[model samples]
Target: GFADGTLRLGHLEVKASVLTHDAVPDGLTKLDNGDSTDGQAVYADTAGGQVRKVAVEAVLGSPQQIAPAGTAVVAADYRLGGTEERPEKSFVTVDATGIGRLSRTESRTNMMTGEVTETLTSSVLPGLPTGVKVTTVIMNTAADMVLVADNTGTLYRYDTHNFNAPVLAETLKPLPEGVTLTGIRFLIGEQSIVLTGSDGSVDVYFRLPRDNAKSSDGYTLIRAHQLEKHRGAVVAIDASQRGKMFVTADDTGEVWLRHSTSEQTLLKLKPADINGHYQAVALSPRENEIFAVTDGGQVYNWDIEADHPETTLKTIFGKVWYEGYPEPTYTWQSSSGTDAFEPKLSLVPLIFGTIKATVYSLLFAIPIALGAAIYTSEFVHPSVRAVVKPVMEMMASLPSVVLGFIAALILAPVVETWIAAVIISIAVVPTAWLISAFLWQLLPGPVALRYGGWPKFALMFAVLFLAANLSIAISPLFERLFFAGNFKAWANGSVGSSLAFTTLLILPAVVGILYFVGERVLPSQIYEIMRSPNRTIAGVADFVRWIITLMVGGIISWVLAGLLIGVGLDPRGGIVDTFVQRNTMIVGFAMGFAVIPIIYTIAEDALNSVPEHLRGASLGCGATQWQTAIRVILPTAMSGVFAAIMVGMGRAVGETMIVVMAAGNTPVMDWNIFNGLRALSANIAVELPEAVKGGTLYRMLFLAALSLFAITFIVNTLAEIVRQKFRKRAAQL
Candidate 1:
């Protein structure tokens, strides 16, 4: 359609001229009638600055003026209100001053005379600035929202839900200095806008809620992504009806096919390939072909092959600067309710989550599983071993989903309540065990020999049980002393509390180092005295030395923590940050419970398989039963123990239901034991059912599965190699 009211149909190859309307004195500024078959079209006349409706036929009907004269209509849009067969029509006109009028037409029929009459109603849309030269006025299909662009590069967003009292939602200046906004159009979903600049820059802008905003309707327009720049001014832009893909053509005769979400330039066609410089371009209804027409009456069509343009190696694996994010980050939000939502498909977080879950699970599982294996195989009586081994093996049959259910519904809350006690137990239980062992050595030789083996194990268990209960009883005092009565608040608060938390966390390491250094630095006379034949004297000396070591280690840790804080190294981020209830610690505990039975069973079987003669020989040489087991049996079974831990690791890596239900399923890249995580397996289990076949999310899920497989393959291969080395070393032993 031209400004002279000449309507044409068909392409350049075969064109047909439609009815030409009566000439206007100042030509038509805009023409719109929607998809109407009634031959009625509303157009804006510049001469009288009036919006007039005219019937198109062999001879055009008399112009029925809608708006009053002298009000210049700069732009107008029409939309269908009812069914296509009997459409109620509405149109809005924006004058040069940016004020708009919405007019709706309703038809009524006289039943007796069979005469049809039309009624027109008008309402003022108020919000836009007055006296500004309006260049474009666009209304969404619902007619409740409008965008007005004036000559100044500013875009006005209006909420016209109440047409007579429209609200101005936001205004945006998306262009930079010296770069004029050439045109703007809504993408397929109308939630995003494609803004083109005179400098050939194309950018996407969308509405996002302001962070911590006070108002419910507080949203700001943000420039999300910038596509490939054109060589010259972009003349035409059109978006596909089905997807986020769009086509842009520049005056330099270059056409580029781009996707909004992935920010990918799928294809580019030069002027030589298209044979014309198109001034206007459009995507076909099916989005399979692009049709473009040049001002010189030349038309060109190109087929587009852009399936899965949103997925690439870089987009899937690397950090992406997504629509509303301030910086590039790894994210994995795959699907949303709206068509305009951008898919964040990065797999880095999932992978990190898998590793974190495995490592934490192993940390909790290995010591307990191996300790139980050693005790059952060597220290415990055969009857106790017989009962314990079967019970441990039976634990492996418990379903992971059942464990996850218990963890999420019961254990998580309990652990959160007793978290301070749990932390205190880490230090208290081991120290209590050492004190109990020293006390046992102090007992008379006759009584010690009489209450050995099962009695000894029972005694140690009682000591640990008491230690655990004591830790729980003192939990409040411990929190008050170190954490200011609130562990979470203290841990996440100032540097002083962070330093205190860091010191406690590193206390065990400090103690271990001090023990090693003390063994070398302490007088030989002291060790000899601790090993004296007098049981009471040796035990008392050993207890005093252990107490002194603990106190020194605590003092050193406090100093080290202060130095770390002084250098801006607070222990409140990365792996350890703000605490949550259903977090990595709870998941680790649940997953560790699931992994322990596997590791313990395999390791116990391997320890039992070791030849009894080796143990007998070591004991025959006057070494203790503990010495025989630690020096001979453990080394010979090291290969199997290593393999058991590796197998348990594989189990943890592939765990889905447990992490899904208990881990909170957040795809965040933090190692904080108190924070939640989402693993690759859990992600696949959660999202696969909703993913469309052959879609980007479905393919990415498959890729996630492949990555899991590769991780297990590499881990098992390395385990086997290391196991072989251990086996050869055991052969020499």
Candidate 2:
């Protein structure tokens, strides 16, 4: 195995064994008699991982002549003891150049004179939560190390640099028998500490130097503010930037605002309203705002500027005047808006937008939905009804974003081009229907049966198609005929207003159409009720039409008035507001279509449930099937239809997504269908993400949510009451 062809491994081993000499200078040793030599010797201990003592001998022959292959020996010119105590009590002995060779025990040494030192003992409190142990210890920015624990409240502090090692640091005992710390915060440039305890109390303290002779604990406890408005354990605390004001919340969901000198109850809630046990509080540094979170997971933000934080309604008495009326002595004005200050989330605009968007949508959809619903439910074959209802209802479930994209992208442009055509069709198509019926009557019986009903459907589509296409094809012609120039320009020139009005001019016509459809679809009960009161069909129709017209008209007018009254209805502003308003087109469609299945299912059931003899008796009285259906079946089913419509209205008013996406996000006061608005749910959804957590915007979103919850609750309550009333009425009949 040797490259040199000399198997020298055993020769060297035998030479080393025979090389024992008499106190010899073997293994390259150097003696320092009375002179000095530069050398080093390293030794390793055979026992464990420790070192107890070391002694050095010298060896020299230039740097290259060291013996034992790698060992170096040098004279020991000086010696120094270790400065600090070691945690282990065991040690190992070493010789020459700091290498251990055997096990030994030694006392700890002092750096200055090499003397023994003793270990110190520290105590820590017990029974803290699991995983809650102290890790960091510090007094303040530059103060001595003090005990700090994880969230579970263990304590740690230290006495000196030697104590700075976490293992050597002392853990502070819990507060004396009568007290426990609930909150802790460093304050006043980190020189003072504030501690909050149970029973609405707080203590301030400052750490003094260890050499201080004043107190045994080397600290002074100062009574800062013992706040008591909180009902239970103070679960949360927050302070303003200057520390001039602080707020606290307790388990009961009560909040208290405390100044350096005094305290005030900020808010308190009933157990049911507390929702979540209060767990956290925060005060905005730059604004007069307070935020609190409860264990139940509800968060609330408050504007602390108000004296009465819990009051929902604030009103002021003011003198008012009305045109052509006696001078007003007093009028109640909402304190929410006064002297250039207004509630940030005013419900007026939002309410208006909700109504407007619903009205507009219904204007567009009711004719389609109700007309479809009526035809499908009343005249269409059973198979066709099955197909048609689901298709329409399926549209309800379509993601609103898709519809919105269509409206903003496809429909908006289409409306812009075919606006006049659409208007003309609405006016012309009905007349065409009447004229076509007259022509059909002139046909022979066989021709009529062959062509009447089926041809009517085809003719209906033909007229509509002609109107729509011709309107678009001849839009310029109509525009020239009506305005003699650009219609938008002419509208702007006449009204001296923005272009939004011109674009929205079709709004009134659309509302008229919605009003017509909605009125025409009035539940049979309403018609029966009117007829039972001796009202003729013409009279009933007129009344219902007037009601629908006014409702739709008022909505449109309110938005227009918004323009007249210094509120602009631009897309960015009014479009959003219109969608947020109540009674919007989407609301109407949702409400109306929602009534479809209910009215059909319930009314059908009620009709079927009626004694067959009643309908047979009406027929026996020589009544036609239509008359029997009207006089007996519908009259008996009146309560169910009423109940169904009421339920549908509640559902429509409360649905979040359709309203949120279709209703505009502006909170405006206009009721115009053409304008935009945000509903309570829509407002919350749109703003929740944009709102900074726990700020006014965030709390406003909550308030909107609460309002929506309340509205839905009230609507359902009212619907139930109305349903009962209708039931009683039907029973009387």
Candidate 3:
């Protein structure tokens, strides 16, 4: 029996003469007594194209007549004619009393005469009840057909050419449920019929001449062997046209391909190996391809009789486009342009907006942060450092939304009017510092030492006081000096004539000239530091003071540049405009303020960690405390300070709330400080929740996340590298 779908029988030692040219079995009869016996059958033509089954006791004797009457004898009736004298022509049909018949036309001729003797029944078929179909059928070497009945247990057979004639075929008992036939195979040289089904169903029939069961109305079906191979539902069945091989597939995607060998011969071939369970299977009608699809929507194809399945020729994504489908074919109107509405995830604008915001924020942030680090770490008094560091660090913890609101609602307005006031602050602070230093030098040396550096501090406070008071004090004075008692009125008179260009525009040119002249000659303190090498108390004070100056100046310049870029250099009259609209300094202010605590904590830690021995050693070498801090302690703690700054940078870059709330979200590419800008963290947080899950927007958000993570990673990595380098440098020293 075949593993799942087929069975085969080999040569059965039947008489050679029984293998005749008559491909169809002529007739069958059942002997009485119901036990099997045998009789003669012939392959012959009948009259006028009708086939005839002539019963011949010429060889095998009828068991019914010889033994008890109940004994059954199988026989076949093959004659020279059926209805008319057409020797070479015949018609055949299977006559099962309880089952339906199968008829076909065939041809026959008298070997002695060259003429057509009869027209035989042609395509012979099996007999079965209506609705009880021939679940399996097979044609033998003699062109005889065998069929398994679906209802009444029966195996019916017929020879070609016995059409519309009386021919009793052997009948077998019905099969049990869950035993649907799969294939019917005939061994050409064996004169046998082999039946196979889905699982554990196999039967074989072998007889010399004709069995008496062929003459009976009912015959017992002998189960030869049962096959128990496949574990699932049989999905497909196929046979080689030559009957040499057959195959079957199961719902589990396993296949059994085998060649047929008679009972004693070996007949087996490997089947195709396609992975996964299959729903439907089809062999390509044009090629050696066998295709199947699984329940999970995957399709596969394999070469016929091949060992393994090949690469997946197609996937679902490719399948969609292969049929000419477009990506992004569907779109919805996402917004109605209100506060409730948000922008779409068009790659261009979101990316631009993100870069613009981050650039502005960083442009605003870096100078102030670095400058503050240098000052607090280098110059500020211990008492001042304590207060300033905590305040700044605490500010870092402030919610960015509040800052954003202030920038949008409060700062933007102040910067606008006092744009000039803010710009002037940049020059005012330094000039004030110079004046303060001049005042400190004028103080008596003994008074300066008794104050223990309070003189320098007092000088700075007075300078700041004077500069700010002076700006307020002289603003009206300058307005009158420049605009003839009514700056706005005068400028409006000149610009209102054309509403185009005015002295307000020309002011930038004047400022540009002043700035070019200023860079050529830096502040006096920088000169003082460059000139002094005494490492004296005054030198340390000068350096710290100048460092603080640079920090404040850097912050102001950064903020001013931002404002000029964000809006313009024009000084509006509104106090709100003076703060926010005056320059891009707002971003610098926001970011710098945001990171101050982090940098302060980190820098102080680094400074505190510096070895006390180094400072003591410097002092023993006649260096003053300030000189020790500047020449020895500062350099020794430099690594820690640099680390603090780097970590603070990472903090600034990753600060989401501050940037999101503070950045304007405008997709502009300007470097202006007065304008608001976006940052990556802020953009991602703002857009992520709104993005559809698993869509382009969602993936893009993921990419942004990856980028942010990467930036932090790189910054931390660099910080570590710098820290290690510093450690190595210190160790060498």
Candidate 4:
């Protein structure tokens, strides 16, 4: 028997071939008188005619269907008592007449009738009981006594040596008013008789040994304490062959096991939809198996088995105090070598990976998508806008798998090669616009007044192109100055070096340029909207001074943080080895590429959907184009833009092949931008096909899918709330 839903069986032994006349007679056979339990007729053989031990087995009419039609022999096993050194065992058989026994028997195959031919020995009961017919027999070979219950509920014990002239040892007293005996079993170890009566009750009669001087009969029988009974009349009673635990079956088809030492029911079973008295009950020697048979030959076997440990809740989701660990940890390792390994199936890491991917993707996509959308709607010439809008909208149709392939095979290598160049580009690209805007005003008054928005943008693009090359070209200078020949070596080896180029030139330059353009360089009305309102600060003038202070202060703080993080990276004295490649940078850029078109298309459409008259009114009232776009159109379309960003976010969160190929599939918990992670969708795609059906790993994969669903649902719900708030603000505008 197994908890994994399987049963193991041994080889079958044919009863007739093993129980032949010549073979069984030479062995220690039971005193073949019809008793109770399995009718095991014989067990062992001794060299001489002096067998010391015997075993009872082979119950006759066990299933009731096996009972022969004509004059056939039926067997029951019983103990005939033995010396202190050995216990004597035997079997009892019955014929058509009534309950009878056989001291000897011969069985053979009848050629003509094709039936087992049986011959009974004369060494049996000389005559049947007289005056009252006996219902059940129990033999106590220790005191050479035989017990019997008659039809009138009278119990009698007789000397086993004499059959015809039986010496009666006791005449039992009457029972309760309406009680009638239905079944009986001998409790050999307790020297008691267990009786199941008509009124769903069980009573025990124990034999007490008399002192040698008191009487020649040496023992007296008396009624002992009664136990809890079945709800209906019990039809069969039995116990483990060598145990004190007993079992009973009632008319209602309920079976229960109870110990003779106590009245407590250890186990109970009631099969559904079948209600009738059981004909037989047998407890296996192992104490874990029980068999019940009805009169119609219906047989049922029940077994007790234990479950496998993997399904326990503690092993699935709970934090396990794993061996060899300092503290309990939430881990999600599903399998490893060794049978004793306990699986750690924590969902925390998967959830963290999902959030990390979504966050990085959003950070990379939102600014670029929204900026392009703003340019096309508010600044671009209509002819160019028509081409720009449709082209970006078409990009939305590119397959994500193709994008993932590009990220894995192309983008990761490119980023790894120009790692510093890329970081410089983020700051450089924005400065291009500031520089170009400044350049437009620096032109001669005659030249500036002639061309409008189109020529200004062309200058902006030229500055952007030069700035991009400057960013890439300046990377080597920054590396040599601050990074001791290589930036990767500085990151992977040590912390202190010369001041970075970004620190000496780019930082102060960007700070001065942005601050001046935002306050003193641009229009005063723009300054009025952006500057602090407190008159104590003198508004715009002091605001510029404060801005310079903040920018310089912010740059210093950023450098300090970078140095601190660099120091912490070394795990031992002067050593750090893990290189940064194919990490969050690759995943962010690649997923951002996949996400930008989605966001840009939707956002441009949303911006286009806003009423054109609002823009015209703002411009007609003498507001600059930037002021009109910022103060009017953007706020009105805020809700739709938020929705577009969320849609891109959903795509980022569920992306598989891109992150799977680029994110390294490392199931670790770390937020460092240069490290990789394992996302849930990637894990599922990688593991599901390898998992066995109906196994623990297979179920865990399905659970991971469910976790992804829950994350998406929660994100969408929160996004909806923020969208509603934006919609309300747009209404006010």
State each model's CA lDDT, in order: 0.80, 0.47, 0.48, 0.65
- Residue 664, candidate 2: Cα error in Å is 3.8
On lDDT, the stronger of 1 and 4 is: 1
**Error at 430, model 1, angstroms:** 2.9
lDDT of 4 by residue, 660-730 (tens): 88888777676756678788898899889888997768888898899899888998999999999999987
Residue 482, candidate 2: C-alpha displacement in angstroms: 6.0
Point out the higher-scoring one by lDDT: 1 or 3. Answer: 1
TM-score, predicted candidate 1 vs. hidden true structure: 0.76
Query: Clash totals for all models, in order?
Result: 1, 70, 114, 7
TM-score for predicted model 2 compared with the true structure: 0.42
Best to worst by lDDT, what's the order? Answer: 1, 4, 3, 2
RMSD of each: 9.4, 25.2, 29.1, 22.1
Which one wins on lDDT?
Answer: 1
Error of 2 at 471 (Å): 4.6
Q: Any idea what lDDT model 1 has?
A: 0.80
Q: TM-score per candidate, in order?
A: 0.76, 0.42, 0.41, 0.53
* Evaluation by TM-score, superior candidate among 3 and 4: 4
